[model samples]
Every structure is written in structure tokens, then in C-alpha cells.
Target: MDDEAVIPISALQHYLYCPRQCALIHIEQLWAESQHTAEGRLLHDKADKPKMERRKGVRTVTAMPLAQPQLGITGVADVVEFHTGEDGVEHPYPVEYKRGRPKAYQADEVQLCAQALCLEHMLSCQIPEGALYYGETRRRTVVPFDTALRALTCETISATRAMTVSGRTPSATYSAKLCYNCSLFDLCQPRLLHRGESVQHWLHAQLKGE
Candidate 1:
């Protein structure tokens, strides 16, 4: 795929969180912001600026553009710290910034792993791990790019790309835990749509009976 056709790395995270959410944003071009999203944007203010600095022996680049055309993925890493090794190789360690603490899902990890994959392809070096820094916790959670995570990232990429190509938005399935806090919850109206489906089905059955 060409550069223009590459999928955004963020889409993989959204897909893992909820495929319907991914479809709503990527496929249907819908968006709604909540306090959570606003906070996230504010937290990214520093990382969103492209800059480079060196601390100790580590070279830190913020808002680094990353792309792996082979994987058809592209995105900007919040921070990529390059640590030089004895072999004169600069090992890349990506750090993604988030607004909230760790969640029950692997979406955040998958997003970090996807960044590692892009770096690996671009730098031609193996990345063993990366990290997620949460604003609320003010700490970093290291994530290993193990086989399972790598597989899941690849699967998410494929699924997201396929959904984009198909141009089909998935139906909403309401889950209080997942949907309540979603920035797109009002726009998605999962509960209303799910209820509408039930009513439609009931009406269809009644008509058939008559």
C-alpha cells in the first residue's frame, strides 16, 4: 500500500476497544468529544509538538512520525527514546501517553505494540518492549512486544483495514461498562439503536402472525 492508503495506528486501538467505535470514526466519519477526550488532548499537548532532545545517553524524540508501508500503517509516536548500544545501534523504545489509568482491556498495549512494529520495520531492528504513560497515574506501564501481542496487533491491523475497505459500520451493542464512558456514546446511541432493533423485530413478528 502507498503512504496515502496506510491506516492510522490509533485505529487499531479503537478497533480493539470496540469495532463499532472504530467503524463509527474511521468508516462513518463520526466523532463526539467528551471530557475524557478533552483531557487526553490536553495531556498530549507537549508530546504533540515535534522536538528532539537528549537526556543522559538517551535521545528522545517527541511526536515522531512512524510508518510501515508493508503493514499499511502510519502514525505519530508520542515519544520515542533511542538508546544507543555497544554495537553502535540505537534501540528505539516507544512511549505512548494516555489520559486515564490502565484499563481492563488490551487496547492501550496493542497501540503501543503497533508503534513498536512500525519502528521495527522503519529502523530494521527488533523492539523487545515499549511503555504506556498514564496521566492520571503519572507512571509508565511497560509493555512487552511478545508473540501474542504481536499477533493481536497484526490481526487488529488486518481487521481495521478490511473494515475500512468494506465501508460498513458495525451495529451498536450496548454495554454499560464500555459505552457509558465512550466519547462517541451520545453519537452512537447504542441503547436506542439496540432497542430499536428489538422493536423492529417484534413488529415484524406481529405482522407475520397477522
Candidate 2:
């Protein structure tokens, strides 16, 4: 992968969560850390710190560099736990730390899948699964290497590559649902762009000499 073109793994998940949010973040370069992001950052503060520790069943390495060049993605793994199997085979499971509970959306999945892909390429092993630890729930959610999610993750990577190459943020397609919690609502101006009868309002007024 091109060192300068290193893609943020979060962008893949962000696109899956909301294309508008993805565009606002990666395309328009607009962002603000709300309560959710702040909490998440605080959680990551500890994870980002350098560390190495051993537990009964596993060894933990924090701030590991993970990426999948074939998919054009890269990011830092929060933690990768080393486990030894019954057959004496060593396995690496990348664990992503999240600040909130699991969502119906695919954001977290996409991020985790990207990490799995990265680990696979890095280790030359088939990463069959990974896990997400949510701080709020204090539980680890295991994610299997299913075909559907992998496909979605690949599609997301391609879409993000296309977005960055296009170098143009898409116009806001007004939708109350998408704009509700978006950090870019004000900058995107979905309301201003789509309101008052659209372009027809201006054309009609001009033609009638109003």
C-alpha cells in the first residue's frame, strides 16, 4: 500500500454506517466530537498507551499496526490477544475496543473485519474471527468470519477508494433520518440545499419577474 495513501480503517465502517457521514468526514473534512466520540476517545486513551502483558490464557499487545493492502486499508489495532490452541498452534485475535454497545448498523463490523484482514495479511494466516469489546456493556462480542460480512467489508473498501479518488464530496440528499445525529448537519446544509421548492422556486420567480 502507498504509505501516504494509507486509508483509515474507520472510514470503511463510517461509510457503512452512513454514506453522508462518511462524505462529511473523509470528503468534506468536517467533524466534531460529541459526547459519544468523547467517551470513545477517553476509552481509547488507555488502549493507545504502549503495553505488553500476559494473562493465563493469552498475551496482549496494545497499539499494534494492522492493515490489508489488497483492500487498501490501514489502522492501529487496539489490542491483539495471542492464544495457543490445543494442537499447539498460535493464533492472533485482534480485539477492537468500542465505546458503546453494539448497533444495528455495520460500522463496528466493518472496522473489525478490516482488522482481521490486516492480521491475515500480516501473519499469513487465515483470520477466522475477531472480537469487539464494548466499554459500556463490558462484554466482548465475538464476530465470526462469515461470507456476508466479508463481502460487505470488501465492498465498503472499494467504495471508500472510489470516494477518495473522486475527490469530491457528494451533495446532501436531504433525509431526516440521516441528518438527525450527523455532526455535519450544519455544514452540509441539507435543509438549505433542498428546502423551499428546490430550484423550481427560483426559476419560477425569475421567469415571472417577481
Candidate 3:
């Protein structure tokens, strides 16, 4: 919660999905791997290792470290492709790996844009776009670093930083689809927590009543 604390770039995506989930992981340091997370881990295994390759005027770098101090974000990009133009200029394009199909939200894109922001800072060039590679479809979806998405990504970063400073894990709000898919569902106990208690608290109360 220090004023100078650097938020993990991953927290941006997490916060976009669910602020409570973000706080639970980053602020509370709680983690549990569910099937979904396990699959994601596997998918990222190749990208997690740093490597580089060159082909046909394009250079690819995997597991590239990225950080933007102005935005207070630091993380690694899954892959970054540098394309050479006829003008002999090279453009850096980031590619993010996802374990599942694209979500109905902007979480994935924002994360990719954050990587581009880092590239811009490090390379001193404008990164106009990036891509998201989904595991399920095995296809790359191009994402433009448009004004709207850029603004939203910045807002999410500020909001997430504030949440971290507050040092409060938000109370659970249950959604059948979201909560059911969360890896921390058991630890979160969204339904019970929403009722103003947790499973342990309810169990203790029941024992006392006996």
C-alpha cells in the first residue's frame, strides 16, 4: 500500500474481471489453482520461457519483460513480434496467450494494451495494436490500441491502485457463472460472505447453539 508501490500488470486484468478477486490475490496474497487456472498455466508454459527467433523480416521474442513506471505496472509479455517495414523501421506487436476463448469483457485486451504501453516507453515508438491468442480457438484476435480502450485501461489501473492502498478485500458479491468459475470460490465463500458471515463463522455459531 505504499504510495510508490508498483502494481503488477496482471492485477489490471484481475481488477477488470472482479475487484474483490484482485484484492484477494494481490492484497491478501491468497491463491488456489482450479482447473481453469491449471489450464492457463499449462498454456503459458511455453510463453513463460524467454526465447527469441527471427524469420522473414520478423523477429519474435517470448516472455519479454515489460514495465511502465508512470502507470505503475510491471509484468512480462507472452510474445512480442517485431515487424520490419519497407522503410526499414521495426514495429513491436505484443501477443498475449489465453487459456480459453475470448471473454465478453475487456480484461484481455486491456492487459495486451498495457504491454504495448510498456513497449512504447521502452522502444520510444507508438505501438498501434496487439493480438490475443486464445487456446480454445487457436486463433489470434487483433486488438487496436484505440482511444477508448486506452482510457479504460488507465482508469482500471488507477482504481486498482486505490483498492490496493485501501488494504480492504471487498465483500463478496455472488454471481452463479462468475463465482462458480472462480478458483478461490471456496476461500471466498461468496454466498455466505454476502450473508454477513463466512462458512467458519456459521459453523462456530451452530456449534455454540448445540
Among all candidates shown, the one with the greatest lDDT: 3
44-120, model 3: which lDDT tens digit per residue?
A: 99999999999999999999999888888889999999999999998999999998899999999999999999999
* Pairs that collide, model 3: none
Please, what are the lDDT tens digits per residue for candidate 2 over residues 174-199? 77876766666655567665432323
Residue 49 alpha-carbon offset, candidate 3, angstroms = 0.5
Model 1 residue 188 distance off true place after TM-score fit, in angstroms = 0.8
Model 1, C-alpha of 159: deviation from truth (Å): 0.9
Q: Which runs of model 2 end up more than 4 angstroms from their true locations?
A: 1-5, 194-210
Residue pairs in clash, model 1 = none
Between prediction 1 and prediction 3, the one with superior lDDT is: 3
Which of candidates 1 and 2 is the stronger one according to lDDT? 1
Q: What are the runs in model 3 whose C-alpha is more than 4 Å off?
A: 1-4, 194-210
Top TM-score hit? 3
Q: Candidate 2 at 117: error in angstroms?
A: 0.4
TM-score of each: 0.89, 0.85, 0.91
The C-alpha local distance difference test score for the whole of candidate 2 amounts to 0.79
Ranking by lDDT: 3, 1, 2
Q: List clash counts for every candidate, in order.
A: 0, 0, 0
Model 2, TM vs. native: 0.85
